[model samples]
Target: MTGSRSSSRRALLGAGAVLIPVAAVAVPVVQRAAERSAFLALCAAWHEAKDTHEQFYADNVRTFEDEQRVAGEIDRLDNVALRLEREIAGAPARTCAEMHAKAKVAERMGERASEDIAHSLVADILREGPGA
Candidate 1:
């Protein structure tokens, strides 16, 4: 009985050794394909949302509606989103420290863009003589 149990254990160990490499290779391929699919899905959604937003703005423009406030807000949002995209694209190439630094830069850029948009919106309101 002891000899049979030992043999069974050795067989299991041997099987694991053979399985490990197959799993190691397959896991990464599966993960990468899933990641690519997710990225494509997100890109499609982003494009659809962008198109919808643009169409609404275009219709307003056709009516000669005042869109300075809306435009400023959208510009700030778009800039922040663009910075986020840069960070996401850099993620695979970056170490943890590098990614952190890149994230800090993106945050700073987003903050500055928001501030500039606010300043522009205020200026436009003042120049346009009200409610802009």
Candidate 2:
């Protein structure tokens, strides 16, 4: 019984030794994946907002005031898009690749998913204001 207990403890310690390093490596990979996911969500929302505004203008006649309002909104959205692009450029290479790949998948999911994401993003921006 004593020998069995000692061997069990040794096995447990050996497993921990191996798992600790693996867990340490996995943490950063998980963090990077989360960061990439967030960035991709922002990209999808920005694309949706920009598309909606452009489509509105294209599909309907507009008053001068309406045109001006949309133009300003588009300008603001464009600035947001530019900022997002710059941020993505600064990310790690693997993160950037993941973001781009996920963004492509999000785009292909079409308008419904994008609209929901855009709505959430808009609410957050409104609640937190610019630079949030």
Steric clashes per prediction:
0, 0
Error of 2 at 28 (Å): 1.7
Clashing pairs in 1: none
Residue lDDT tens for model 2, 74-96? 67766765555454334332343
Please provide TM-scores, in order, for all candidate models, with all chains considered together.
0.49, 0.53
lDDT of each candidate versus the true structure: 0.54, 0.59
TM-score of 2: 0.53
lDDT of 1 by residue, 1-132 (tens): 999999999999999999999999999999877765554444444445456556767765544345764777567657655655543443331123433433333354455444433443344335444342
lDDT of 2 at 129: 59
**lDDT of residue 68 for candidate 1:** 68
Error of 1 at 102 (Å): 25
In model 1, the runs with Cα more than 4 Å from the true position are 55-62, 77-132
Q: Give the poorly placed runs of model 2, Cα more than 4 Å off.
A: 55-61, 68-132
